[model samples]
Target chain A: MFRLILVAALACVITSKDVLAQEVRITPDTASFSVEVNGKLITIERNQDTNHKITNEFTKTSRPCPPFCIHPISAAPGVTTVGELEVIDFIETSVAKGNGLLIDSRLPEWFAKGTIPGAVNVPFATLEPSNPYRDQILQALGGVQSGAGWSFAAARDLTLFCNGPWCDQSPRAIRNLVDAGYPADKIRYYRGGMQLWLLLGLTVESPNA
Target chain B: MYRIVVLIAGFLIAVSGMLFLQGGQRDPADFALAEDIVIEDVAQMSARTSQAPATDLSGLTSAVRASLSPETVAAPEEADDMAAMTSGVLAGLGAPAPAPGGDDAMQQATAAVLASLNGATAPTNPAPQSLEAIISQSMQAGESDAYIDALLNEAVTSGSVQVPEALMTVDGRVDTRTLIAAIVQQSMGSADAAEIQAIAAEANAGTTPRAPAVQEVAGERLYTVEQGDSLAYIALIFYKDSGQFERIFEANRDVIASPDKIRVGQQLRIPG
Candidate 1:
């Protein structure tokens, strides 16, 4: 899988036919990147069709506020806000290397429709302390069980996102994690979530499908 | 002497069953009573068969006798009805469901008894269903094209169902698509109509009022759009990979909302 990723990364280095016509680059230097996800080679590149605008339900702009209100640029004191590139970079590095998970904090139904490729769904509700399986999930994320709560001394890095900047699912998830004594610095908040990712025409996969 | 007595009993039971069915068909009151009577007969026969371990005929025999019980007397009537209607439609649909062991012994026994009694005892086959009737019914039932294809093959060979002259390929094989189209004449059996129109309006819905228009480009492998031309079918024609239809759809998304809605006579780019 690693070799496949390396080969894909090399393949992307070669100029594409579209690039010769009109280049759309992820960064000044890099055109695309590849990562191995569940033994499948997931090559993350912007959609080549410039005219391809998403036709899915994610196009809603005027959702009523309390749930869809614009979130803070920063969720908490130590939680860092990351963009699509940072999220992509984190996926290629931390997630692929098994040191972290890029989490889709939306509910499972929303996650089923389409998600940022290489993201794993851990819905915000499941992270609440009220859930009996909360500690089990924390343990899965490399948290050690202590007598009273949990020890995040070895907690895995988690980058969480939901529907977009207006969505609070990820923020609530972060709060849940922080309340359970998970280290805030270990959690990275991707404020763009799915909407901006689709707007930019980055690859979205139906992992649940 | 024992054999003669059993045969005599069988004939009497069959005659009574015919009378009951004729009467039941006349009176609407007997229909629900008939179903209940059939259920009770199955229960008794099922218990008898489990104890006896004899042939399904033995269970069927007892069930026929049990049908004459004061309450139901509907088993033999049901059997008489089953004998009269043995078309592939009812042969496939009308039987009681079979249950595995530990679920319901009566259900299994009922299905077994019916299977034995229902099959045409002699080689003299009844007139088969008409081709149009078979195709429309099977399609309405949501059976696969392959299933309908197989059924058509059997019907055509047996000289029962004739594939219409128009649906016959140049090589003389039945084209199931065109055949289904003959039944659903409006949208040519395209799924796009089913997608847009309300399900209640589905049978005669031609939601796409415009005829499929094709754009021909020079120096391309041009294929004319026939009725029922889907992107997947076109991809199969060009690349032999139906999944590659997505590529054509991406190029043509400006006109159609879905790949399925692609009209006839549009030249698709064959990406090398």
Candidate 2:
């Protein structure tokens, strides 16, 4: 019986390895830099997918990428977090403060079902290669370390949170700010994220509800 | 019999396990209710823009005639004459309403037209006017908490609810707080019960306007919009559906005052 168990465990390990070998990896596990926009040190986050090749193949071949293969960027240097938190704590704090921003890194349905009160929707997939709103976000946080719309020289603080520690939204967001040169001190990350927040018994308002 | 029952149970468990494994390899959408971008829809938006001149001419001719006098062209003879004069009249209007330049702009204009035509159009732009060029276009008209709460309560009472969803890409770096506030404000601003009813009815029918769902970057959690970001392309990249740019603007209302005005380096809060 013990031998059988060992064999099964070995098979599971082999299966896991096989799955790992199937993914493509992107460089810069997390990109951090501060672009000097207007004059504030705006922080930014970038989560790299080391396994892009495998994912592409799977997607193209009409196969699903293995679960947990898509890992979210969680933390980096210069993130100031509000609570001993989970993602939900950041959201609750944001709501309690009645001023901070709560970001939902989950898809639309998750957002619609229930989200941290007053949270906005921004997805990680669209971060790079430029979109029109990048500068606007930096301006709100204060100034990009080096990009345009580094407008707003004032050092306004912001709290960043995502689905959970497993979620890459907060990390990538932080990286984007840091890369833009936003001051790290002004930015806080809620590491516990939404998974924790949901677990913490905080109320989530669904757009649909 | 007992042995056979145990064997059957074991077989069932094995089948369930296989199913789970198969499902585990399925797309995220299979396991969870997530947003998906429809590439065809995005392609369609761009196609529509390219075809804008043709559409605009037809629309303008009708609009001008409609505004002038229904009696003038209500008859078949007048209608024939009107059709004959349509091109000349439209040419006089000029430029045929430019295609909003990009997908985001187009989406913004479309939303505005829809709202206005439906009645209950708020100030065309809600953000402080100075920043109009840099802000994301208003997603929904602003709604007050009191009004939203009342609406929600009413929906609950009616045993139906209209929940709004973010259908646009999360690529833009707009303020999340500002976006939600904007949406609430817009919802609250919808003072016309009839228009509100229109939205509610559509939502309840499970026919929330079709838009694309956002996809995640491999191994990354965020993407910042740099200089040269256009709404259409962004929608294509993230949501795979460009028609949902208004939804994106609505989600990021704080930093984005106008969809056409995003500056480089803005940090957008990305939804999954």
Model 2 scores what on Cα lDDT?
A: 0.43
Candidate 1, A175: how far from true, in Å? Answer: 0.8
Query: What would the per-residue lDDT of candidate 1 be over residues B1-272, giving only the tens digit for each residue?
Result: 67655655565565455546445234766677779978987887677556634336454445334222232233332222222212211112224323222122222222322222222121112334898677654654356566676778778877887653434433344555444443443343334432322221232234343322434567544455555455654543444444466776676667656654554555556554
Fnat per model, in the order shown: 0.00, 0.00
RMSD of each: 36.9, 27.5
Model 1 misplaced regions, further than 4 Å:
A1-21, B1-272
Report the lDDT tens digits of candidate 2 across residue range A1-209. Answer: 44544555555565555455434222224233222222222332222332122221112211111111234333556566555333334434443343344555443323444665545544432222233545444444345445433533565555666656544456666776666666676677776665555444344455334
- State the DockQ of every prediction: 0.00, 0.01
lDDT of 2 at B66: 38
- Please tell me how candidate 1 rates in CAPRI terms: incorrect
Model 2 segments more than 4 A misplaced: A1-74, A81-99, A125-129, A140-155, B1-272
Write model 2 residue lDDT over B86-127, tens digit each, in one string.
322332244342223333433333343333222233233433
Assess the local accuracy of residue A191 in candidate 2 as a C-alpha lDDT between 0 and 100: 66
Show what share of the native A-B interface contacts model 1 retains: 0.00
What is the interface root-mean-square deviation of candidate 1? 37.3
